[model samples]
Target chain A: MELTRRDAVAALAAVGATGGVAVGVRRMQDREGGEDAATDGASAGDPSDRDTNEGTVRATMVAVAEVVYPGEVDGIDEFVDRFLDGRLDGSAHASGLREAVGELADASQAWHDAPVEELPAAEREELLRGIGADTADEDPDGTTAERVRYYVVNDLLLALYASPTGGELVGIENPQGHPGGAESYQRGPP
Target chain B: MSGAESVGDGRSGGDGTTGDDVDRTPVPNADVCVVGAGPAGALVADRLAADREVVVLDAGPRFDPDDRLARRERAIRPAYDRPDVWDVGGERDAHENAGEWFYPLNHARVKGIGGSTLHWQGMVMRLHEDDFNSGTVRGVGPDWPIDYADLRPYYAEAERELGVAGGSGVDNPHAPPREEPHPMPAFEPSYSDSLFAEACEELGIDIHSVPNARNSEPYDDRSPCVGYGTCQPVCPSGAKYDATVHVDRAEAAGATVIDRAPVQYLDHDADRVTAAVYATPDGGEHRQEADAFVVAAGGVETPRLLLLSESEAYPDGLANSSGAVGRFFMDHLFAGAGGTLDEPTRQNHVGFYTSACDEFYDDADEERAPFKLEFFNYAGPSPVEMALSGDDWGDPLLERLRDGYGNHVAMGGLVEQLPRADSRITLDDDRVDDRGNPVPRIEWTVDDRALSTIERANEVQVAILEELGAEVEWVAGPDATGPAYHHMGTTRMSDDPAEGVVDPDCRTHDLENCWIASSSVFPTSGAMNPTLTIAALALRVGDGVDAWL
Candidate 1:
């Protein structure tokens, strides 16, 4: 599917929040060469070349997105796929995210007898809260709950609010990295 | 000095030489060679290329204007993996810090064709009349060799050249006297600025339109600000003035601009500069001989260049007869207060500031230094920053953004820092750059007086935020504040040859033909943005070089 401005802004927001994801979003946006320019890591190579476990991380993140994202949000699977493409470079941040997703998968397997992606929406929410991710402070190197919150839950919210559609939901029609132009800023929110 | 008739003997005037006309043709000898393609050098070269054979050398690459949007996007990406968008860091830009506070030399400077203007916020202000006589009136710093009247005409000319947008004297009453209105109409205050204005009015403090080099309308063949809302690090639209505009003008005027050409040192004699020996990207060194030279390499590199040019005849350095080449360094320190209110301030909607308060600038006391207060339109955090930094998620996260995203306001102040002899830029022989030259070792000192000034400014800022019923989350003092990167006073101007490096005409006191056109020649730090003054002095240097030729 063609990358839209909304998708580009979401990709940039998600990359910033996750630290090492959505490297190909700028390239996809550049093929159109319109107003939007992603510019996260145009030099980064194939994301699969760096790490082998991006599948579990991407799957876990998608499952978490369904739990943490508001019900009004749509296209969960495609959005997660687009945001995760070229994000998993062989960086420490990418490894931490993978490890965090692994921890969540481990918890799901221990109690629900399946990976997080296989669990139903209600069970996924319960598993996240049962691991204390709903209450723990967001930290990359802290408890399993904190890592889950830091890498998965916050990343989804950031990608949402950073996108044009999500920003408009909270009166930020143009998020910080997008060029909504001078008129967007000159007037107050309608 | 020979007259203009005797200059440019072999070269044709305005031959349409451009920066792209770069080859290994070994730089042609010129009547004037300007080192550093920054605002100072660009203006000087543009002016002198009208009559003299001028050649400009810049250490950094001439960035493609079309790629600025991409650069801005790179800057907008996550701070952790964001590349050096401007290519500012590396062994070539490395330095050492030798003081209580680490001086962010490389972070603060851009060693490219447009220099720091490529990343500057474009706020332009003329120094107040009292700023010139600080020592005589306030007993704070040395009085400048020339006063406001001497630079008044040049300031007007620089404003016209840069296409400044400013409010009328009545709108900005505290500004220095001006003979002409700004070239363009002033930008209206941002929505956040209006919120601060109300609180400032209640506190009996007046805020006025800030003069900026960014275009208000289509001026100088450039588009007006599209507000890409990223003025600090990058202005995707060429709406904001950078030195490249003048560099292009200089090129069109037949001045040869050689980018990626870092001038190592000058080949000088007893009373004149003979040539500027520079390095190419391919690690090739060539000497561009000239009758006159202008060193406009900002504050840090200017002194670093001088100190690197030490020889037997002038063992201290080329222009260090007074032993003051790198002494008396100065920078403006910042103070700020930010908080959240119940109502929306609409912060971050506009990136550049449109209003400021200079009422406290000329009202310095014994304990408190002069300061200028700036109202930040991009206060607090962006929705993305707020989302990522917060601990909440799901519907609660959306609710939190609804409550927190727009209710932020902030005030920042630039407090005057008195020039201290100990706060200087020296060379560390132990460390070297990529070219195997000693790196600049900076010793920055924030004295108790400057700290007291910050405390006083913070009090004013806090009062304004409080007047607006803000929570007053933080107040910046010595511990939280840092330099504004307005580097000045390194090679201060003085009429006496023994007191300073440059004379009233900005010519080196020791070398008659060598001139400095950067903010390095400022005698005092006035808490005003220094680019306009730098442009004025550079124009004056252009005039002086024309007269010398």
Candidate 2:
């Protein structure tokens, strides 16, 4: 019953194919049942197949986010996808969020073809630190890896832990709160 | 201003009724009608619907937090500017023209079940007792007909309803005595909060944890906050307070919520509102008759609704016999000072705001100037806003954010705005909303009293920053500064009709059934967040309506 970001993206891709992107996006959302399927497919293959550049970036950003908030839940990938694909248009602050992810991915590939998990924690940390330092120096004008690092990590944290899946992780037994608490302290609806 | 009427789907209306409506459409109705699903309306309906029929109507559509997050890549985005096609008043000119400085003043409030509380920062504080009796104590602004004692019980009820989390220890001198402890523990403070608290202690000022409506524990069925940093967009965890929770409770209690029901005007008889007329999303007109009417449509929309409903009974507007439908508007004045701290005290804290000050809240000596310096809470703007406001990108931007994020502590002052007759909300001939209601024309100018208070507060902010070992900078503006969204005192409460619009009970003096449920009924703009007071007054108004029924 848990919804994942991958399911949302796949549904979004299907909607895009049907030429009802807006309607499809709204529909996919109306029914909250598609997350399991989306996340299932998401974990099976490399996200790079969808949009190579953006996918590579997203994966790299996810790796960087894992460094900031280790052992984050699964929804972080979907959050990055939504941001890069332009879901939060009215609110997004940075323009090259997706591109920064791609650069990090490219750097990771160039440095070592091994999956991020294969690398030792110290090596991974060093790689991210090096990338951040280099990006900070090179793109004095563009969104440095340092800046993007925080964005990616923060978004991932919010998606993995702040979303419903994350709520389950923290063992929030009441979901909204106890019924009496709902009536007494309830400010809004669930 | 130009008036051009465009019906839905680019059609023009020839006879006031659009051709789309000419095809007779069925009207929609609910049992207990809630005009707006904002904090006040939502809370009232949620509580009242336990026994009565209730229908909550909002002008906007319901939004899923997950979907919203997926759309806006960043967890927290600015109130203004977005990737979505939805016009959340995203256009910058609206905020700029309104003189909003801190955050976007006219950002889109979600039209769905939750209302604006979805994105609020959840800093809930009770207004000082002096705020209720400002006219008597300060001898400025119109006197409140009802005192704090009259509202204390309701405030307690509201606190319970909102599930406020704070330490209500007797040591706190400024707050009224609470009958019960907070529903949950206070949110853990950020490094900035601790730094501010230390600085306040050094200055011999008492600082404590700010009371928030955000759930610190699973009080209701909702989950606790997860420190998502998306409090401005939507709390995906449902930890932060929003009206949607109440709408759900209302629904469970047999209350219905109708989405996209935009009320246009009210049909009134001499002193009683007979019915409310609304235009649906499909360009259809619907009228709902009610025994009693509650106008919880916010300060801007409420007055605009009254002015739009001008009739023969009251030529100026509904309940405007006193000519005070949209007068005496007030918003808290905010200013910030930033400087380098002496120590590396920054840590990744869980929540945004932690410390507060009340030492200068009640200092009313004329020789010492009349304003209070309270701490302003923010984890700084989002990465994008910080980048935009500071030097464009690179190490400088990163260094600024990293260095300033926790080290910087801001103190904002909310001065009591003297109710001048000129600071009013009138109808704008040019700008019209989608429903053709005239956009409220705000003709406000800060009085000498407010300016003097601001000047004094600015000096105090600078002194405090210096004392805290911070290198300081102060930002100020003309009479109008900060966001107008914290709207107050348009339909003020008073003992006499000549001085204000609504009576002590928030009922319009001339209209028997018509009631105003917003910060508009405030006689003086106090130095605290208006959300708590707005909810308290709404609870009081709901009780009055229930009594009348």
Candidate 3:
């Protein structure tokens, strides 16, 4: 039961599985298939039932997050979900993740008609890059991409690889447990 | 004011009663009480919690890390302008010398759970060997009664607790040898860091990975750093080390942390600090009794607490017999010098600036004035902040932002400030906080040593920039004077009570049961960031208190 750094890493990997669940949930919601959406959903039209010409742009943000950083901890998905739900409140920056995801969805819809899964890796990367470039151009005033690139890239990587598993991925020891060997605090001269 | 009658001065006692009308509210008691959830008090409380009944009080409310990060993007919003909301420091009155814009010196000290470490940059550097025995070696500053060696083990413990990211192979002669490698690899150097490294190498100065408390890879349950520029604000991913991590650990071990309670003064019996009188946010007065008391209200409020606790036992202030409670204040004097590089130097890499030079760390060449100069490796100010400060502004700002969003590298110096008795913190007569306590009056003036150090650091920094074919712009002299949030060394620790406010164990000279935990107990304020050392010292003090209890 001793929690080594490796165990911590394993925990993080486990957390990432939740991202897949989030992606599935979003897909279902987009199809208007759930009872929860019937009363409070943004749209009432069923995309699958009609040729509505609305071109459903289903972005697998979880996959995108994973591609940005592979082999992240399991809890990452949970963290992201909580952040999107405004549950992980700390500072004002946490909301950026949700906002960024919304922008990514909007940008993805504008670029392609196919599901994110059907798009080639290059195409997906191009879509992301365009979004990033556009966001960078508009910066603080960016309507769809406001702080999305910074938040998505940073949060995904941090969730998956920034934890103990990430250290293992790079062959670095988790210094928190072994204080004497590697945890020397450094400061400037007095 | 004579008969303890209502002065109607708006300053109420703990019980929401004006004047000295002994409040009727039930007072809480503990074996030991500590004020402020910052590194100093938290470490002390963490150490004492095992054996003694400990209570820690903080003025700020609990911080939900998620909420904090979510709101961080609104930093420039009006909601961010509230006083005492964030730990950002600035004088109330706008002085002419105060820059045109309010240079936010956000100390990142949080109110709720972890204190300021919640938003810390996580750069954890140890004090150099010279830092401990500066007075003995150079005869310029007072020597710390406890040397670097005395705190080595604790530093190691602190590192473990913080989950620092660094390599053990790097030979830092001043730091104690480590048996294990870093928990995580050093963060990859940013493009600017690499350029600075090359420039330093060209200048014959050593550069290496800067040690940080952030998880490069995951250790513990925390995630790894993702190179987000939010290091100064809040880390939503929980990769950054914050005091809340320890607070959580301590709570798991059965420690109680009370938030939204600000200690007004120390309640004493004769020479001993018996309890702390505090005012709750709801305007209720409560007294908490304890066997021991620790004041970690930071340098400003710690001294302010002592001065306000004017009982008949020690009228000049508790533990102020040496008259050193608020004297010898020191902060790392920082200055930035920028130069355009010949090549891009990969200054846009996610995390590249990790190396540093100690050529001027302690050079007694007289020309250098025995100071340390650290090459800042972290990302500089945002493009907007930089545009405002840089030569480019307005239309030029837009052009520069387009041309060099990720193409500029600048090196800054975290210079040492010589400790002087005159650079002290007293009570501000005109100002009072929400708690009715006098605001900390910081009267500081840079001495020749600091000026000389800055001058020499600028010279070397400019030289390195020039050697790298960079166009250099140095900000020094009167124009460069600005307060760094890394404040330290007001109530220093020493063996002799006459020379310092606290003993080697951080015990106050006058109050047997009172202790201090903060950088305020540092005798010598090293040139580097003090958080790591402060945490380490707190761990050491925690160990001491554990034994004592």
Candidate 4:
């Protein structure tokens, strides 16, 4: 249960992530947890009332993906980034996501003295559970915990199981959309 | 009327050409002009194109077969959001629900060249012998003018044409008599079907391989099913048969197919249709004159067209002297039962149903209607969708998915609804589609007899689930059931001209040269899927039209 940068990499390897995908995951993780952005949370104006932009949303989502995705899941950051690339269009869904992530960031800053992305992985998990996101019914226009469950936690899990690598870890080589061909379906699991 | 202006909303064609870029050249006169490029029109056009000049006019665009992968992706990523993945929406596909029970007409149909077959589940079942002799056998619905004996050869030919895959003739206990086996070998049942078969064996219910138009092996130069599991919305692989195959064949055999040309109305004299007036994407209208005319515009649209073509000669509507243009609208209601099993059923791995029980199909009487019970292969929660919608995350989410995803099982039934005079499609006076044509008003009603039949079906489904030691979560009775979208019985067929729209040959009773090739000519809504029967009847109509010419 030890949370480290190596743990994330090992998780990616466990799901048989390709080297290219593993590298992409590392790049996304570095972009979020770089020294400059880590200090920006502390140096910025009132963290609880900070501006909620696409950068904050992406960083918060990456942090959330680390907690929600299974330990066996590979390439969490890159997979999430790619999934969010299509989802975070300037639609109402994107706006709701930004608002929800901002709420989580505000709570982390007010209670734990740091942004959600700046907090340790255990504290981030503790913060999410403390706000009742673990048991809240997902609602876009409801409580802060409900919105976090809807946009952040569920979104990460959706991206994981829907991905080919993560789906194979659960013995679903071909999920709903991916074509596994007739032979794959006709034969029982090995 | 229903044909012309309603389909000219400037949508892009399947081949990536916009409607505005369509060739506006006047189509030359033809030996036969077929409206609606669905299975019915495609078959008739393909049949007649060899020796005669055939022109097919469709209200929708032709879809490119190559673009199915992208369409499949859309079905997967936003699975819940986009039910109509074929771009079947907007004002062009609008309608009014006049019935107490809201009938989702637009959701049920696609106006493209392949018609609803573009997204149909590909289950092709022939009507039982009792289905043809319903009135004489059970005194419920009217008897079909032509019996199963008359359609036997055509059904065989249609099976060959559509490349149906099924078990031997001896497999199904209630199967109608057929000479040859299915064209291709049958697809094996899903893992879940084996579990259901165990329970059905105890209850004396017979389970047989479902006859489907999808390929088990490569046939007719199309790929076999690749198991995308998005068969309902989009079949990324061309394994499932759609009407586009016949449409392409018709074109290859020298038929002139005009996509995105919605017919306004037919120009006719007292006895025969002379020309079909259709609209282009531009505000221009042109008439395609022909020696004969065939309307294959499906149940809802075909009736709407006839009703829209009201004139002085035929005051009721064109070829509607019998006043039976849209009198007997019918559809099959779906009855379902599902629950959680302790063992893994491994559901949702395969998309389409592979096993069915037709034992109750011949049991129609005054008490209960005929029905086909299907073992659903795609029942239960999808791992991704279920995990995302839950209130848990991380390891707890994985635990919930492991416990919930593979242990779900369900069974579905297609219960037949008898034809009622009031359950009909009429043109709405107030509401109009995008083209300013009066939309088709669907007035559907389920009587006590149909409700009782649904209850009977639910009982059987629930019994099977109980036998499997399932938790018995939900049962869909009459109130919870909805239509399976097998539109039939409108513009029904009758031997006597006074009682029906088309005669035995599917020719209009009043018009000398007008014919209908769609399932709209069906007299009864059989408990089976209607595509095979539609194909057989369409081919019969083609031969009849050819001989008449």
Q: TM-score, each model? A: 0.81, 0.71, 0.69, 0.82
Look at candidate 4 and tell me the lDDT of residue B401.
72
In candidate 4, the residue pairs with backbone N, CA or C atoms under 3 Å apart (3 or more residues apart, or in different chains) clash, namely B3-B262, B3-B263, B4-B262, B4-B263, B4-B264, B14-B62, B14-B63, B14-B64
TM-score, chain B only, every model? 0.94, 0.85, 0.85, 0.95
Q: Which of the CAPRI classes, incorrect, acceptable, medium or high, describes model 2? A: incorrect
Displacement of the residue B425 alpha carbon in candidate 4, Å: 0.6
For model 1 chain B, give the 10-residue run with minimal summed lDDT. B1-10
**What is the Å distance of residue B191 in model 1 from its true position?**
2.4
Second chain TM-score for model 1:
0.94
User: What CAPRI-style quality would you assign to candidate 3?
Assistant: incorrect
Model 3: per-residue Cα lDDT over A1-190, one tens digit each: 1224343333223222112333344456658754433211212343321221112211344546434533333443444433232211211232333455555666666788655546776676677667653224223224443354444543333333323443233222221111111121121111
Best-first order by TM-score:
4, 1, 2, 3
Q: Compute the lDDT of residue A118 as modeled in candidate 1.
A: 97
> Per-prediction DockQ scores?
0.19, 0.05, 0.03, 0.20
Minimum summed lDDT over a 10-residue window in model 2 chain B is located at B1-10
> Candidate 2: which stretches are off by over 4 Å?
A1-190, B1-31, B71-87, B90-105, B108-112, B188-190, B347-351, B365-406, B475-481
lDDT to native, each model: 0.78, 0.56, 0.57, 0.78
Second chain of candidate 2: TM-score? 0.85
